[model samples]
Target: MGQTVNLKQRLAYNYLRDGSTKFLCYGGAGGGGKSWLGCEWLMQCCYFLPGTRWFAGRNNLKDSRASISVTFGKVAQWHGFTGYRLTNDGIEFDNGSEIIFLDLTYYPVKDPLYERFGSLEFTGGWIEEGGQVNGLAFSVLQTRIGRHLNDKYGIPGKILITCNPKKNWLYDLFYKPWKEGTLEDGYAFVQALVQDNPFATEDYIETLRNTNDKVTKERLYFGNWEYDDDPAVLCDYDAICDLFTNEHVKPSGVSSGSADLAMKGRDRFVAGHWKGNVCYIKLDQGYSTGKSIETDLKRMMIECSIPRSMMIADSDGLGNYLESYLNGIKEFHGGKQPINPEFDNLKSECGFKLAELINNRQIRVVCTDAQRERIKKELSVLKQDHIDADTRRKGIISKEKMKEILGFSPDYLDMLIMAMYFRIKPVPKRPKAKLGDI
Candidate 1:
């Protein structure tokens, strides 16, 4: 007997089956049969596309076994497909097609570039709980697929992601763009809520309805993307997203540039040229040596007519190497005292100023989709540190903490924040009155 799927799952299958669509996001809420659809799709493909390889990935292997693997078992039994058996790592079929299970957790120190999967070759894959995976991991996974038996089978390589509402990369890469009708070609998003799933348990539905957590209810029950609210958040998500479309931020003022050169550990070198508040990214690539960045940056400045007197680069780590060559360029040290006494340090002051400029729609960024997504991911982590402690000086969260949360260095946001150095004015001190004058 053939397995049955709801209309929403069927719609996702349509995208998966299409030759044009390469990436697909199936669901946005619980009980939408996301796992079932993903498992069944991979299973059927394993049988149909003989000699092909596939992967089923999640945040961890244990979660994949407990959730996605269990769902695969049920889906297999329901269809009465007995041609496959579970192995130590994954499922292997009689036709030689295999479905490998993978742990897609983001560990910066161990596998910042996800090079562990560098040699992997797969025809397609599914990422369950896609929101839990980091953007860089997903990006690397995309490259690994479409390398196994695709030409032999006459099928396009596809990667399906199943997720609930989350304000991570999925939101920036899918939901927001889908809402704006600007999602790129070859990518598709199909949102399905609990109500759309007919097989959902009544008890589970009732539990979701009865939950007291407003954010959880809104996310799981209604699939709302805008329900999240955190006190420490310095800028609104919408405002951060609007930075790319702020056409009113005219480019009429001083021409300047900012660069954040990576010292090491999988961080990239990022540089941007600016005309007043409008930023135009010139370079964003992995660092091999300071020579390449220095050459590229000098070219950009010369091309943009930006002088070394107006250019700024962080004087930390490898940035010093770039600065040593480009003499007369302004240097920005994050640990130095802030021009504004209210901020804890130079970095904190600029971070807050960047957030203000974003929220006030005073900044505009011109870049490609990949760059835009990276910028959004970086700035989304800009939040106040010690928001509740009145005794502490006002400061944004530290780079180490941001790295922990983002799974990588926030080079883009750091460069953008460093650009605020030009915007900050030194606060004047009041002079003491003379006795005779008084």
Candidate 2:
């Protein structure tokens, strides 16, 4: 019976007062006293609820030790809850309501841990850094709350989740759902920013305001999902398309070719030719026979007058088929030589890199406004969806769903990514004239 805490403390106290809240989520920007409030609330719960059991979850084991266990230890000691043992892994209170600290990141997959967690007869639970835990893991933890509520306790169990919004699936599962009003019945979402806490220092407020990047600033200071508004076109699309108006194009030098071959029926085959930083895109209308593709590629190379060595093809899926075919062909001036080509996975390695190049103005696109709009539409529709039993069992969301949700085909984007991956090099320069020639 240390000095009674305030309303913030009572929120936790009331939750455990009878152990009835099904889910309580407290989240927002940093330095809003989320952790301190959570620790205090949890202590109140343990103190009032005689035999109730609770758990504290962290994103990882190390984080559990540094953040939850250590913070709760201080709060427990301050309140005169004497008979407790603090170990590297968890904290156990003498009253039988222990906060077993564990990390959700022990397994990237979720299902294997459900059996282990299901065995626990927990009254309730808390997730610190809720943003980092996968949505699937959170669902599994929710199932474990059953142990506390029964004919005897007659009180419904609950979970307390606290986190700062950051990149991850949590934003989709928790924050987005809260915004959309789609969270399950009996769940409550309370948002708190630095301004909400009188304890936050002025200097901290100033630092948050000074962050220049809009995304970082919005997330940390304003707690909004601010999309980047920078223009998608690297070069003025109108200006670049104007350059290609003259049908008789002269080669400044050998051009490089990059292809993104479509293997999935829904995707498209896209190829681009780059001379210096300028790129010309060609959208494949249909999947042609292997021989037809080889012929088309050879014809394009001959027309562009680009040597085989300078060409690079995407080596994923059907692209690999094309690469193998071209490797065996013997039609170039270099005497039966295969095109020295490169390959890349468009999603993981190529896409973001290309986005960076566009943002940096190191790459140029034709910038067809209609095409750009279509691509944007597709990207906007991308969503997390369940794919299979493996994903459903593990609580994992599918990345492929994002692509499908995007309405327009991502073939062109894929091609551009592959092209950018292959074309990355030190900016080419002409050899200097003899020193005396100027």
Candidate 3:
């Protein structure tokens, strides 16, 4: 006999079978029978829709081949499905339907770049561990759907993602919007905890319940959205997430801001808008260039109504060009004397003060949860050391060292430091304009 269908899976498949929704996200926690559902859905689709093509995979090919592919074959056999053979591509049905198993990862791009998918076409596909994939990858995959072997198939191409609770793009793209009742018309999110699944093992459920980490317990068992694990995290997760509610409503006056041009690998150009104390990030994601970022920064200033003079950007050769364009920007160099004597330089001082704001609960950041995670990760990984010669001085980790820890530069957090830099550092008064000529 085939695997039993749970109520949650039944409802989710009904939505997928209707052909009304383009995207279906099912299951929020582990042991929700999600993988079983994936196997059943793909089999049914291939059997019903003749000559259609589909893809299924996770982040690792070895894992997908060793497990996902094997599971599908077993489930198909149990259902009395016949005349299908498994290959490297997928299981090919006699009707010409195929499910291509794959493994997608970031490889070279800091974020997974879907360049491999540029030429491939498909009817629809399922992502096993959806939380592990980035949003841009999904965007790329969506475009390729609805293009192949779908002409005869009455069902419009649909993408299904089975994943546990994660605070990445999935949260903002599906979970958060679903919670707020703002999910788009053609998309659906199905919430499923372990208890909701009929197939969950008693021991497995017990393990999840007994997890020592609060974040792991909330996520793997209950599918909670607000939890993370990071060492030395300056900003509290609750403190940052709470700013979204209507509890704190300050006037929309932006006092100062920051700009981070693409410096090295994995770093995107960013423009941060600071209102009171919260920082809103705007980035140049698609196009990466000096001129492009120059335009993005100027646009942010006008949009936020921040005076051009109050913003600071790193003083590189490109930054000098941007300085000429804005005419109202500060050139930041970390070598400048710190506002605090204990810190070695401007960058270290800025980092110290930013941490103070976060640890003290004095700052609220207006950023997407995913962006907030990036910032939090960077801050938490940064280690502070004490200098030997100067007993009062506190030394910040070098960029080279931080890169070793994080595998990339902390571009966003750097921009945030610049955003908060102006607040604590005293601006020297303009030199006395005693005119020798006037």
The clash count for each model shown is 0, 1, 0
Better of 2 and 3 by lDDT: 3
lDDT of candidate 2 over 1-438, digit per residue (tens) = 564444444454554454445777776676766777677766666666666777788877788878876677677667776766777657666776667777677453454454567677777778888767756667788788758744456767777788776534455545667787897666666667777767679999888888886655676688763232223322222232333343333334558776655543545666667775566765464465556667778787778766676666653355556657667321111111112222112233344445455445455545466655444433332222232333331111123444423323565655554554454443356789997988
Candidate 1: list runs displaced more than 4 Å: 227-333, 336-379, 384-438
The list of candidate 3 runs beyond 4 A from truth reads 1-3, 77-83, 109-113, 229-235, 242-331, 334-357, 360-415, 419-438
Note the residue pairs that clash in candidate 2: 378-406
Positional deviation of 99 in candidate 2, in angstroms?
1.1
State every prediction's TM-score relative to the real structure.
Answer: 0.63, 0.58, 0.65
Please tell me which model should have the higher lDDT, number 1 or number 2. 1
* Model 1 lDDT tens row, 22-89: 99987888788898899999999998888889999999988876777788889989998889888768
User: Model 1 — which ten-residue stretch has the worst lDDT?
Assistant: 314-323
**lDDT score, candidate 2, position 32:** 64
Q: Determine the C-alpha RMSD for candidate 1 after optimal superposition of all C-alphas.
A: 7.8
TM-score of decoy 1: 0.63
In model 3, the Cα lDDT at residue 19 comes to 62
Q: Clashing residue pairs, candidate 3?
A: none
